[model samples]
Target chain A: MPRRTTRGQAAAAASARRPLFAATIALAMALGGQAGAQQACEVKLGALGPMSGPAAQWGLAMLGAAELAAAEANARNFTVAGRRCTVSVVSYDTRYTAEGAAAGINNLASQGVRFVIGPVGSPEVTGAKPVATRHNLLMFANSYAKNAIGPQWPLVFHLGPGPSEWAAPIVLMAQQQFGMRSVVVVAPNDQGGTDIASVDAEVYRSLGITATEEYYQRGTTNFAPIVTRILSSRPDAVDTASSPPGDSGLIVRQLRQAGFTGPIGHLGGPGTEEIIRVAGGIDVLKNFYWYEVVPTEDPQVRAIADEYKRLLGRDAPENTNMWLWVVGARMTLRAMETAGTTTDTRKVAEALRAMPVDDPNVGRGSWAGQRFFGINQELSLPFGAGLIVDGQNRGVRRIEVGQ
Target chain B: MHEFWSAAIIGVSLGAQYALLALGFTLIFGILGVINFAHGGFYALGGYVAYSAVSGLGLPYPLAVLAAVLVTAALGYVYELFVIERFVDDHLATMMLTLGLYLMISTGLLAVFGPQSPEFSFPVKGSYSIGALRIAKENLVVLAVCGCAIGAIYWLIYRTDLGRALRALADDRQVATTQGMRPRLLFPLAFGLATGLAGLTGALVTPILALSPSAGDPVLVTSFLTVILGGLGSIAGATIAALIVGFIEAYASVYLGGSAGALVLFIMVLVILLARPTGLFGRQIRGA
Candidate 1:
């Protein structure tokens, strides 16, 4: 490194790079430590997720998936570089912040990790992707925001469909299967709300259906009057894309109790647990539907679900946990194997973008095609949506709806 | 129609909660001339202790709540002897010290309990119905507790010798000292009574509201407004103010179609202050 600088500025610059260098040395040691135990080629991948915070539940699930995949691969004596290769993971917490994701990417890059998976949430992905690009590392992101796309976002692959994309199937389902016309769409007036409204409005307008949209803040806890006004609108369908669960559950329960027996659909992951837990479980979710990107009814889904129960020592939450982890690790493992190289980041990235990866979880359709659809003019995700038919009597059933 | 009942029920329940803490604030102000800002801390701590007993020590829910109130009431005596006893004549110091105490207790609790909340399950279920209008069973319990606290306040302030001393202290701490009333000792009694009221309120509300490290902010604000509206010195007036604030918030949430519950409480406070100045029940300060 060449430096023609003032003493203070040069010292600070050197000091800043010190940690990066140290992190690299430590990662080298970590890689060397694993390599010493095996005569195979090896490389480190970074597991980046929010291991704490409100979304820690989702983050931990991602970690669990990565660990399980690594363990399975190691046990199987994975081959790479014409020799056995063991994948080593250097886990970092995104802390669910934009700054945290950027920091994680920097730290992971310094450690020589070619691929970094994680730091979920649209904001974190947006923040981390730039850091990854700066370091020229491949980012296998877990963000579900459709807006988290474009040429500006390069080498960042989404493991799931975007938030805006989740609304399409529900809107389509309402018009086709349920034959619903007018719909009351209540969403928090945040970024999440803005995205869902765009898709919902377009779908309804195209179908000759009127969608009445009411925006509330994400922090709102009260929902009684909002629910009443919504009911007064007398829509045949209600869609709540509430970030906060208490209001969503309260509104839905009140809407049902008020005898608005129309087809009710929640808009996100909050519709799965936060709503269900607050509403006192399955009894409250009767005849309710929501859109998801993954198929919940496959034999593989059941196998994972059963494994989740064994791991957690109880019937696991219907939509969280193992699903987050496995899909991420599943993508990583297959891509690594298909890439057939342990040394090349670009080759691994190409494998990630390759069409027809044949992941069973993809359900007859593939996310490989559109993996990063808008991300960096490459790696478009297979963005789609589905329905989880979780009602009172039959428990929560996963119905595939996404293409 | 649902709006009316939902608002009414919500208001009454919320008011009952506000009345508990406000009653404590009014008591300390009425006697010590110092606002026990730490009343919220006591309220929060009492909830934590009761929760610990029921879950941590495996005690029954009612027993945990009872133990919590008693233990918190005792701490009030300790606080009075060590802290408030030094600031009896200085109202400004009293408020400042109590506020400091509030921060201390809150920080201490944060250190001990992480931000993740503990869940408390209530044993009761369903509401009692009178014709078409139904009241939730848990809400009914809060009402019952509020009623008891008010009745006890009536007995403590008007019916007992201890009550006479308390009133004497309120009239003139210096004169009360001359009249063979020991306010140094009575200070603890007053503080205990005020804090105990909040402790009991916390224990009572724990089952209904999820307990978080910072659950006292909304309650503290509500209590302040309740005291201001009820005239700050009149117990019955505080109860009335609490009910009004409660019902109005409920109505706002149900009929107004917005998150104006907190705003409604403040507006009512502002209106009452503009109208009455000294408050509905507060006594004007006499020449020292």
Candidate 2:
């Protein structure tokens, strides 16, 4: 039979175990420090993107691309400044908001990371650019904002050309395929939406097609009222411009349910797969056209998925933007390797700007943002235009962007 | 005229859903004197639980919804009884606890389900057309179910003995305890009932729209706004306010475009709050 413990005895017993708890904590910290000190060279790359919202697919793609590139570089023994270094990625979920991205940049900076490979929306880029510049961190950002990569932000590089470069051709192709005379572009009223929708609408107007821009508040779950408003306009087609895939899918489904049978276009980023999934299926999607970041049907381009799986031990993110982001991340890593220093962001930026825009998977591309953002730091890779006619998949067709 | 009718249909459907959500939100605050910040987590959890029951366990849709309500209600009951009970009197403490719970629930869902909207859809597809005005059959089902749930909640709170005890406790805890009412026993029941309503709403509505881990983020904001406008502790106010909010959102979004419409809704709420600090049907705040 154990004796009943008094309060005094309990206090004495707790005091006796305090040293052991402190010692355990000290030992863990010491081991962590020792592991860090033992590493000869480690390059920390920040991967910032929305990881938990409707735009999560794009952000997850960004993270996947960064991880894949880092893994690939490790396999080849990525060397910087004559020292073999292992690349590690630090990711922060920006939640597709400006403040989230800005804070993420500061967080990465606090962790001694000098480069970043994400923040994949207009508002995020807008928020992150100032913080990234203030922290001297070079960012490879992807945004369709008109001022995505301007002269003001020299260290910020665009992941790919926005609607400024690709929208016209896609609009032309869509027009040819669907023969639509008028279209309504629906998107969130935020910077992320307005910038891209306005550009896409301008392209439609340029092509002699009537385009109406209907902006909605972000975080709107149901689009029925908006759909009713859209139907009131009675447009020939509806283009979901930069609305997160979830929102776009709901809009598409609602439109169809409301008896709008015309072709639907996603002139924003690459999220057709997510849209199709969320909108039920291809049958529910009916006639659809969208921008594909790369010619997904091309074996050379499709090989990236196989490589990602081989290297990362997991299937690649389904969003096609992952392929594009892989190019961006791999290029950033290669630039650091070329410049021979991960800490010197300026040298890395210079190296990246000077490096020829070429990828084994995406083929050769040109840097062409001077006409749009007044900076020639945009990666204008060849992309694809995908289509679905009457619920039939009409595979993506490759389209080249000349500098 | 067609657009008017379409917006009205959407408004009524949205009103029913909002009323269900706000009633739950106001219930926890009213009786328990604790703002359940994890209300949205329960909503999202409800959606995921139903999704799992149907998709993982191969249960029928109706059964899945029932499972969602039971699971969420039980979880809420346990959480309130054990964790929240300790800090029920401390507003700040309860707020922190509920908020932390929300974070855990959302993060857990994200980890388990991943950041993609699963292919869960309303079983009934297509819409019923009345000339130019079209309403999704799924929305109609949700509206009807929400109406019944609201009615059931009213009956439970007004016509039942449990309601009288709960209301008695809400009016004067010290007196109610002296009069043979056990707060510890009734509080959990009230909490479970409220969360079950949220769960029911989530199960019925998410499939019609979309279901994701973060779906509850907006739900929480909208519910908070609606409850505040309705006078925080008034059931009648919450019901009327939800419909007002729904109609305002639909009509404004339809007539004034989406962006302006949302702005207008917030401004109107602000104006109403300024005009009546206690809300349209609110009583004076009781001193503990």
State which candidate has the highest TM-score: 2
Clashes of 1: 16
> How much is A135 displaced in model 1, in angstroms?
9.3
What candidate 2 keeps of the native contacts, as a fraction, is 0.87
Model 1 lDDT tens row, B82-197: 98888767988988888888878766776786433454545565556554444567667777878788788889889999998888888777788888998778889888988888
lDDT of 2 by residue, B95-156 (tens): 99999999999999999999899988888877888887788888888998899999998998
lDDT of 2 by residue, A1-403 (tens): 9989999999999999999999999999998876764474788889999898899999999999999999999999999877788999999999999999999999999998888998899999999999999999999999999888899898999998888778888888889998999999999999999999999999999999999999998899999889999989899999998999989998988898888999999999889988998898999889999998888999999999999999988899989999999999999999999998878999999999999999999999988888777888989888998989999999998998842
Give me the runs in candidate 2 sitting further than 4 Å from their true place.
A1-40
Go through the candidates in order and give each one's DockQ. Answer: 0.19, 0.62
Clash counts per candidate, in order, are: 16, 0
Writing each residue's lDDT as its tens digit, candidate 1 over A281-349 gives 556556566654344445665576565455545554333444544665666666778788765667776
